[model samples]
Target chain A: MLGRGEIAIVGAAETTQLGAIPGMSQIMLHADAALNAMADAGLKPSDIDGVACVGPMMPQQIAHYLGITPKWVDGTGVGGCSFMLHVRHAAAAIHAGYANTILITHGESGKSRINATPRPPEPESLNGQFEAPFGPFGPPTLFPIPVLRYMKTHGVTHEDLATVAVVQREWAGKNPRAMFRDPITVDDVLNSRMIAYPFRILQCCLVTDGGGALILTKSDRAKDFPTRPVYILGTGESVETNMVSQMADFTSSRAFRVAGPTAIEAAGIDRKDVDHLMIYDAFAHLPLYGLEDLGFCKPGEAAGFIREGNTRPGGKLPLNTNGGGLSYTHTGMYGMFALQESVRQMRGTAPAQVPGAKISVCHGVGGMFSASGTIVFSNERP
Target chain B: MLAPGRAKPKPTPETKHFWDGCKQGKLLLQRCGDTGKAYFPPRPFSPYTGTRNVSVFEASGRATLHSYVIHHRPVPGFTPPYAIAVVELEEGPRMMTNIVECEQTPEALQLDMRLEIAFTPMDEEITLPLFRPAKGGR
Candidate 1:
């Protein structure tokens, strides 16, 4: 597993501003965050030897745009989980002597649609042929199927899901950067206009434009960095069926199950060792699934776990303290922000810092729980 | 406010028969001869065994609702508040479809409710297979 603590994140930063950028294209945001991270690390773009991003051939694009000619590159775009996987892949590449320093960047102009990239509509693709014909707009249309099924089986009430949004908003109140900092109640969530049955507007993430970047190098060389290093204790990534129906089980994400356990096992750490957590909350039910699949709670125990305030601020396990994608900034794929928050918390520099946090776990999902990436980090090496 | 247009699906060689069967008001299941596994959305090779020795058979059109969501957003061609459903077919494979001729509500669209296949013609050459509450519970 490249031995725990082999790689460390030496620099991390998001674009100076988030939300509603009508001028900057998506790629420009990538460059902006990359430059910001470079400045934070006190390293020029030329110092980076590796680059990674989501989608095909993006590593080459971001690297060249940042004025870097990399020896190694990875473009592992598995939906929102892509950046999390990029970190895992970059760490492995570094350990394998493929490169010394790696850069990972994420940028999505989700709301503004400035210079937006259009994905080809493959009508003949399995999902296009089978699922899309049924008239679902997007995740809002499809995700509720699994969640409704989850509710019936697990006895998770509609209000229980609403509580997920309420609690996260309470945390968001402390984050000035959060898009929705106003306090919300469970009634607010339940009464909000329904986008899909079982999902209100409050349960869904906001549409915003943002970008983030990270730099990683061997931990042995990390002390020279300008910021406190967040060592990579372990990472795991996996993918499941693209069509949610084909998911082996609707109530659980197999990708999350695989990735979460692999990371904790590789790190040789138990759940108790985690001082902070970030489970990508693209929707209210996601954190519920993430909690169970990642072994943070027993099956059917997560909804009540949150309702009781276990994950809210001042709770025993403070999760998504950045307010999460639900109340924070969600620039389409939200994994990058989750990782960024984990880095900040581990360094005790988070906007809503978890005091003296030494270890943090960030879990990400892509394409309706179709893919998952889990990473464990620590400010201290075992 | 589902946009007033529906995205059409194009069939490939592997899936042509399934679409053709839909045209004839029949649902088809792809069965792998080697593995005895019947799968949905027909393909050339077995997803489990990777064997190309697959053939199609008529499905009974009986299914039970697995899960569903009532979408209030605008789907091109679909009005607001329609049920998008996944049904477990009698043959055992689940299919993503829509529920027609029933109230799109939690009370009406109960999980594990019995449903039967229904078809909607998109255009002259294309017919979509959907589901509705089955008569007399199977």
Candidate 2:
């Protein structure tokens, strides 16, 4: 458990601009995020002894770009959730006295890049033989199939899924870093151009080219730093299957069901103690399914919960305070944003801060809900 | 030249029986001879008991519509405006298949709706097992 260690988030930073930045390479974006995060923690580049990254990005590439060599390096590619999982790894590494300060980073340029040639998957890559043959090539299409299944099982309408987009857009209106700040109505969501059925343009997240980074160190060490430290209370990770087609339940994610309990147990807290939530919302329906699988709501009741405004601002539980991937920026790796939002909430720095947020839960699902990572954060460490 | 429909999925020696059953409009699942536990994406060996003597058995195509969504996007082979559903078979296996011969609307899809297998021939070597609302389109 991360709580057994002394790790805490001392700094966080995200690229100021999301969406199309024509000139910058992915490495530049990563370096920019790293520099800003170090500056936010009031630490120099030499202070970081560890580096971790998620997805297809390379850790050595980022290290070279930053002009620093980390003693410990990990390039865990567990899809979008890899960064949250890295927090746990960092905690263990720090407790083992391997590294005192660690930097977890992510960067991607999904949009504004046209491939003259399609990059082939590695011969041994899990996706190479299993999924590429099927038509669910991208994350957007892969998730919609399950979203449709959820809608059918729960009697959730397209408008119900749109409600998620509408609420996030409302939250984005307050966030200057959000990619789309304009207010949108549920009708607008329904009327938006359809990418996949039941999923309109609004329901899908934007393909913004950006980066985010976080700095983690011992809680005692963070006291010397300028910013308040958000202690990592617990962390859990689980994977059901590598391929989407092999999963037993398409609508219900096994990863969340398995990882959520472990996280809550590791945190030594009950579900009622969580004050805010930062669930990965690669698509609007993901968080809804996540909430159900995490036991926040009963099966087939997430749509009703969202319809009653339980997840909006001033609701019982405010979610995605940074506006989430739907309205914010989804750099393919959405776990970075979830952790960033949780840290902001714990430190009382969120644009839409929940009052007296003592404990917060951040969750991320990687690769079509096949893998899940959950972490619980607290303002005070035991 | 490429054909206009779903390409035939080549079944290896392990999966040939499963695809053959689908062509016959029979849902076939592999059950371990030792444990009698059914599994899907048919394997030559049983995962439960690690038994090599896995037996292929005809499964009751009757199932409940566990969940579904209507997709407007067209894939390489599937047409636009198709409904993909996750059906929980009577034998406790779940699989993804398309729903046909029913209006693709939320009101039309009810949870736990009873469905029966409907096979559609895609090409010479491929036959997909789809589902439609049972009897009265329920």
Best by lDDT: 1
What is candidate 1's CAPRI-style docking category based on DockQ? medium
Clashing pairs in 2: A148-B68, A148-B69, A149-B68, A197-B72
Q: Give the per-residue lDDT of model 2 (tens digit) for A294-332.
A: 888899888888889888888888888788999888877
How well does candidate 2 score on lDDT at residue B107?
74
Those runs of model 1 whose alpha carbons end farther than 4 Å from true positions after fitting are B1-4
lDDT of each: 0.89, 0.78
Model 2, residue B27: distance off in Å is 5.3
* lDDT by residue (tens digit), candidate 1, A1-382: 4989999999899988898888788899898888999999999988999999986338888987889989998888788878889999999999999999899998889899887776644788988888888887777776667987899899999999999999989888999999999998889889999988889899999899989999999999999998999999989989998898888788999999999999999988999878898999888999999999999999999999998989988888999999999998998889999999999998889989999898899999998878999999999977
True-vs-predicted CA distance for residue A146, candidate 1, Å: 0.5
